[model samples]
Target: MKYDVIVMGAGHNGLVAAAYLAKAGKRVLMLEAADEIGGATASVRAFKEYDALLSRYSYLVALLPDQIIQDLGLNFETISREVSSFTPYKKEGKDFGLHISRVWDKETEDSFIELTGSAHEGKAWQEFYSEVEKFAQKMAPTFLEPLRTRREMKTLIGQDSTWEYLVEKPMAEVIQSKFKDDLVRGVVLTDALIGTFASAQSIQSNICFLYHLMGNGTGEWKVPRGGMISLVNELERIVQSAGVEIRTDAEVTQVSTDSVGVRVQTKKGDSFTAEFLLSNAAPAHLDRIRGKKSESALSGSQIKINMLLRTLPRLKSGADSRRAFSGTFHINESYSELEDAYVTAAKGEIPKHAPSEMYCHTLSDPSILSEELAQQGYHTLTLFGLHTPAELFETDPESSKKIAVQRCIDALNSYLIDPLESVLAKNSDGSLCIETKSPLDLEKDVRLPGGNIFHRDLTFPFKEEGDAQIWGVETDDPRIFICGAGAQRGGGVSGIPGHNAAMAVLAKG
Candidate 1:
């Protein structure tokens, strides 16, 4: 069938693009390789025996702009986490922790002072994030607009020193020079490394860090009230109402662009023709299908572990479990440990003490659990193991997965007064209600191309000098565009790429 636009994936981004185009009176057809949609933004009943719906991948919502929500009239909502993060550590045989509130408070200040032995690091923390917040405010408005060159963006931001440290210099240098405490630096640096596998000294980390902090101007990571799927469901509703035709399990096997239009053939023998095509698939995946050599990118380097805990575990630091697990729970993620883990993973070995972070979604919003389960004190724990690149599991996924999961458990146990296993909910088969996804597993399941969640390395949001790119969603072929994480200024759950791609197509009119 001939269409105005053929979206080659029904993930959230594709849906966003399709919805926008369809609403503008363009005929759009959305296709998905999987039986369902949502892509990494999906939420599923990972533990079937349980009544909880877990955001199987990409749990938090930080980058989604309110503009998209309002424009699309989406009913989706994200709940803010009161506690920002909790990092537990043992100093000279005494257990302690640093607890930071979402908004600056005495508890957060006191916690910082207690850990760093003064207000110096706390002051640095406030000043650093305050600068970032200002920078984010300036950058956020430009996300949905055309690509801005580095010079243009810097001028627009108007924070020369902040831009120099944040954009020009490596993240490691700024982080090391700004914060004195290793744990504090690690906490701050974690934003730069989430889903990205790069050393702090690498420019790649700088890009990731920028995206992490620049989300919606505040960079606040919030939990989707009804799991990640709620956002997808709202997008689905918008697209369907806008007359977007969606076909599941319609994987595009071949894509060819001509002067007239683009042609697509699916694995199911279905054919489609469109004036323009938008790919929500990773660029590497699209390149493979288009018969082009894919670009080199770092393999996905984080492990996702989801668990249904019977109850939250008590922390060794004596902080309230409800509070500690409510926010990002850092385990063995000290700055030195993070660099060491990266070094180990780079050498093709999972770090013996793999750094990970955990959070309890149910704590922030109990709606994901059934009334019975919520009343029974059930909670969900999500663990993300860093620096465990896909290559570590290439030879033996099973063996490596076991080792990686064990390392995460061991690390968490060290900081917990109550053992994790003791608090885990059990399945009907006598198995614990826990699931793990290695980088390799993600590739097999979601086609993430080497399991890199950001789809290749993330790029700096702005363009270099003399670039002709407009929306940053443009491709070599005028009739095609990338509307996925592979696009510049893409990555995370943000709909910027999708929105930009739609605007690009609309602008062509």
Candidate 2:
């Protein structure tokens, strides 16, 4: 078969790329290795007996550009959380927490004062984020355009102090200097470490932090109306409507490119040729398929736990369970502890106290549950344990996974008035309604190379001086391009890479 473009994965990014190309009158074929699509953005009924749908992998919507949704006319929607985050702690023999709202309010101000022993920290928090908001407002729109040089992006942002701390220096310096409280510092730092195995001092953390906050200008992590799958299904609908051909269970095993065009061979021995090929798979995976040396990257360093709870666990802090669980709940994730966990994990040992955070998706949108389940007060909790890298599970994977899961549970229980296990829904077989995905499991299930969620370490969303690439999606071969998370500015649930790659191909004609 021949096509104007062949997208080598039916992941959401591939779907987005195909939708744009087909809408532009190109003949595009999208092939998926898996039996179904969505990649890490899938939502599934983890428990067979329950009617609850859980976002099995990536949960929140942050980096996806609103322009893509508008351009593609996607019917998907995301709802903002009423609360931002609640971090519980034990201080001087008393249990308390810091609660913040999505929009600042007096109650949030009181909580910050109570937690930090004054209103000064909260004031600093506002000032720091306000500056970041300025930077985001300037930079968010640039993702869909051709790559800007670092100096040019800095100039465009036009905030020298903001750029100095966020771009030039390590994130740790600003985090520490801005927030005096340890827990407050940790809360700020968590954004830098999601799925990324890096210390606060690493410039890598700065890149991760930038992407986390630059989404849609506001950087609010919203819940998809149904689940993560809603975005995929909508994109699937758009691509189909645009007349893009799709093939599941067709894994592209080899890719060859020449001046004329590109050719790919699937695992089933099926072949296809295209004037241009876009890789929606990781760059490392693409390199292997193209018979080139793959580059090394940090292994994915987080464990994802999905649970169906009979009731939301009450916090020892005495905050409203509804408010606490609705937003991000931090456990054992203080600044010092996060760095310590990284040091321990870097040495190939699971942290004795694994730092984890969880939120109740059902709190934001109960529509994912059946009427009976919702009426019964059942909710779904998704927990992510950080710093448990793939290397830690290399020996006795199952045993190590069990240990990591238990550590996360223990950490959560420390601040809960009711133990998490007791509130968990049970299956007909009496097994707990919960599951954990180690980094190894992600690689096996989704091919996220060592479970690195961003496909590799994320790069600054710009080009270097004297770089020749226009769209930042180009590879060494003109006929080949990256249309996935491996592309520059192509991390998270964002479809920027797909849009850019399509534009790159269109420009050639």
Question: Which model scores highest in lDDT?
Answer: 2
Give the alpha-carbon lDDT of every model.
0.93, 0.93
Q: Output the worst ten-in-a-row residue range by lDDT, candidate 1.
A: 1-10
Q: After superposition, how far is residue 242 of candidate 1 from its true place, in Å?
A: 0.6
Residue 226 CA displacement from its true place in model 1, Å: 0.2
For each candidate, what TM-score against the reference?
0.99, 0.99
What TM-score does model 1 achieve against the real structure? 0.99
Q: Compose the digit string of candidate 1's lDDT tens values, residues 361-410.
A: 99999999999999999999999999999999989899999999999999
lDDT for model 1, please.
0.93
lDDT tens digits by residue: candidate 2, 1-509: 35999999988899899999999999999989999998999999999999998999999998899999999999999999999999999899999998989899998999999988899989999999999999999999999999999999999999999999999999999999999998999999999999899999999999999999999998899999999999999999999988889999999999987778888999999999999999999999999988899879998999999999999888888899999989998888899999999999999899988898899999989999999999999999999999999999998999999999999998899898899889999999999999999999999999999999999989999989999989889998889999999899998899999999999999988
Which residue pairs clash within candidate 1?
A: none
